[model samples]
Target: MGRSGPAACGQTVAYGLAVGVALAATVQAAKADPLQDPYGTWTLQAENDAVSTLKGTSDQYYTSGLRFGWTSGTNNQPPAISNLNSFIWGPGTQRIAIGLQQLIFTPRQTQVSQPAPGDRPYAGVLLATVNLISDTDVTRSVAGIQAGVLGSYAGGYQVQNGFHSLISDTPNRGWSHQLPNQPILEIDAGRTWRLPLITRYGISADVLPEVSGEAGDFRTYAQIGGTVRIGQGLDSDFGTPRITPGLDGTDAYKATRPFVWYAFAGADGQAVAYDATLQGSTFRSGEPHVSKIWDVGEFEGGAAVLWHGFRLSYTQTWQTNEFQNSKALFNFGSVALSAKF
Candidate 1:
C-alpha cells in the first residue's frame, strides 16, 4: 500500500477541508461549560466484538477499534476557532480535539485461508482526526476531518494476530486478501439538540436528538437518531463517546457533584451511499467485495459513572447485517475512560 492512489485527488481535497475545519472550528474537544478553565481532558476508548469469547472463539464484522482523544476546555479556545464557530453557530462555547483511531473488520470465517464467498472482505483502517464541537445549552454542533490508510498499511495483521496470540485464540488466516492499501479521507459533521424532561431533587433526565453524516472515499453515510438518559448530572454532556458513523459523544463531562451516574438507550437508521470496505479498493481495479445493503439499523444501551474529573462508561451495540445474502447480526462492546485536566 502506498500514500498516493486513484483517489489522490479526492484525498487532497478532503485533507484541505479537514485542515480548514480544524483551524477554523478547533478540534473534537473537552469539558462542560462549567469546567471551561484553561486546561483540557484526555480520553481512551476501545470497541470489540468479543462477545463470542465465552465460546472460546472470535466474533467478526466490524470487530475491533481503539481511539485516544483529547478535548480543549470549553472556554479559552483559540481566537480563530472562537470567531468561526460563533459565526457558524451563532454564539456558543467551543472545544477542539486531535486524535488517532484504528478499526478492524473481518468475516465470520476468519479461520479460512481463502476469502469467503459472498462475505465481507478483511479490512483495517488507521486514521488521524481533528474535531471541533460548539455548544449551547440547547444544541451542540460538531465537525471533523480524518485522513489515513485502509488495508495492510493499517497493521491489522500485527495488532489482531498479536492480540489473538496473547489470548491463545485462532489467528485470522485471510489477511493476505484484505482490502488493498489505499489512502482514506472523510469529512464528518453533526448537530445534536437537548430536550430536558426532568431536573429536580438531585435527579435529571433528558432527550438528545441528532442528525449527522460522513463523506469521503472510505465511507459516506447519513444518520438520524436520539438518546434518552436519566442520571444525576444530566448537564454533564450529551452522551457517551462512539467510534463514528453512529451516536456522538464528548470526552468531557460537567462535574456537578462528587459522584454521578446514568443509564441510556438509543437507536438510529442509516442510508449508506458508499463504503469502500464493502466495495473493495477505492483506487484499485480488481478486488474482492460483497454486495452491500444500502440501509442499516442499529440500537445500543449503556451506563456511565462520573466521579469528579474521571469518567468510565461502557456500551453494547446491536446492528443489522450490512451485506447482501448475509443474515448476521453484529453485537459489539465499547468501553471508554476519560480524565479531566
Candidate 2:
C-alpha cells in the first residue's frame, strides 16, 4: 500500500486527532481542579511506523499497518499482552488515567503458480495480534504515567511453556504461510514530583525491547524527560478562567479547558530519550540470540480545545534516533471523541 493510503500515513493523523479531541474535552472540565471520581478509558491503535534510511549507520527500516486495540491492566501495572482494557486517564486532564490493548486482524499476501497459461490468483490470510495502551492524569501539581506490554507467542492453549512461539504457520490456499511473529513489548511509565521552583516540571520515561524475542539477548532503552508550565497557570494564553467566544466563527468558548489546550498552551514542550541496550530475548523457536539496540529521541508539542465533555486536539511528535548513524523521523496526529462517566 502507498505511504499515504488509508492504512498508512493518513490513517495515523486521523486517529491521533480523534483521540486527542476526546482527551481535550474531558480535561477542560477538570483543569487545575482535582475531581472526586476522575476516571475513564480510551482505546489504543497503532497508526503508522515510518522510517527513513540513515546512510551510514542503520539499514533501511520500517513497519506499517500496526495493531489496533484497547488496554488491559491497572493504573499502576503495565498494560497486559492480552486484548482488554480498564481505566484510561488523559495526559492533559488531571482527572484520571487509563490504558488499553487491542487485537487486530491483518491480511498477508500469497502467490501461487498456475498449471495453465493464465494469471494465478492471489490469496491472503489474517494475522491476529494484541496492542497495548497507557493513559494517565496530570494535575497541576501531580502527574502519573502509564505502561503497556505485548509479547508474541504461540500455542497459548497449553499452560506450561507453550506460550512462547515467535513463528507460526497456518494453512492458506493449500499452502503453509510461515509467519515470524515479532515479540514486541513496551514499558511506559511517568511520575511528577512537586518542586519548590515556581515552574512545575516532571520527568517521564519508557522502555522497549529493541529486538524481537530472545529476551536475554535483547536491546533495551529508557526515556528520561520532563514538562514545564511556561507561565503562571492563571496567566497562560489558554484563558483567564472565563469563556471568551470569538466575535465571528462558531468556535465558541475561549478558555484553557482541561485536556484541550492548544500547542504550547500553558505547558511547555516535553523531551524524552530512548536509552536501552541489547540483552537478547526468549523465544519458542529458539533461534540463536539476536543483537539489537535503539538510541532515539523525541520532541512533542500539542494544542487542544474542550467544551462540556467534548474534546479536539492536535499533537506533533518529532523523532530522531542514533541507531542508523543519520536521522530517522516520524510524526503523530490524532483526533478522538469520548465521554467521562
TM-score of each: 0.86, 0.38
Query: Which candidate wins on lDDT?
Result: 1
What lDDT tens digits, residue by residue, belong to model 2 across residues 131-202?
Answer: 222222222211222232222333211211121232343222211222233444443332332222343453
**For candidate 2, what is the TM-score?**
0.38
How well is each residue in 1-341 modelled by candidate 1, as lDDT tens digits? Answer: 76786698789999999999865543323223323545588989998887332222255778889999988877677788777667766556788888999999888788899977888889999999988878866668888899999999999888999998999987889999999899999998899877779888878898989999999998999999999999887777778898987887767567667888999999988999989989988787679888888899989889999886888989888889799866555778889999988
Q: In model 1, which range of ten residues has the least summed lDDT?
A: 26-35
Itemize residue pairs with steric clashes in candidate 1. Answer: 27-96, 27-97, 27-131, 28-97, 28-131, 29-71, 29-96, 29-97, 30-71
Provide the global lDDT of candidate 2 against the true structure.
Answer: 0.28
Residue 188, candidate 2: how far off, in angstroms? 4.7
Q: Which residue runs of candidate 1 sit more than 4 Å off their true CA positions?
A: 1-37, 51-57
Instruction: Give the Å shift of residue 251 in candidate 2.
Output: 24
